[model samples]
Target: MGFIEEFKHAYAGDETHHYHVARKQVTCLHCGGEDFDRGSALLNTTGLTFLRLDWVNREAHLLICAGCGEIRLFLEKPDRV
Candidate 1:
């Protein structure tokens, strides 16, 4: 699917407002700022092990504090695969 479809698939039918509520609880570690610029990282890996399917690529969520430019990268919690 496309980007929008992928997002919908990930969140199911839940609204993103819940994320806003959770966001309110976040604080920058460096400067203790509440405001942040959020984004996602699309990553791809193609090393020897990855080529042999020993490793898989995944996306990361980024939270950058506006005040101090400190960044936090969030990866999904691992589950049984």
Candidate 2:
């Protein structure tokens, strides 16, 4: 499934018991819009910097606004095993 669909599934299913995703009050800062496109924050060069620093433990989540293309970042804590 797509990132957004996966997010919706996790939010509505038992997957949320083990994982945390910030879907609350997420809006576009630039356009003040409520619609967004979910994606991986590590899909870009910026997230690659963390890999180079051995900081790959954490995962960065991204929400791209459908209106003005504003991106919001949310960092996930490292998983244990």
Q: All models: lDDT?
A: 0.46, 0.47
Model 1 Cα lDDT, one tens digit per residue, 1-81: 232112112333322211232334566778877665665555444332344633544565655566786766555421211
| TM of each candidate vs. truth | 0.47, 0.47
Give the per-residue lDDT digits (tens) of candidate 2, residues 18-42.
1224434666678887665555533
Top lDDT model: 2
Candidate 2: the clashing residue pairs are: none
* Cα-lDDT of candidate 2: 0.47
Global fold similarity of model 1 (TM-score): 0.47
Give the poorly placed runs of model 2, Cα more than 4 Å off.
1-23, 43-56, 77-81
Local lDDT at 34 for model 1:
64
RMSD of each: 9.2, 9.1
Q: Candidate 2, residue 54: CA error in Å?
A: 6.3
Q: Give the poorly placed runs of model 1, Cα more than 4 Å off.
A: 1-24, 46-57, 76-81
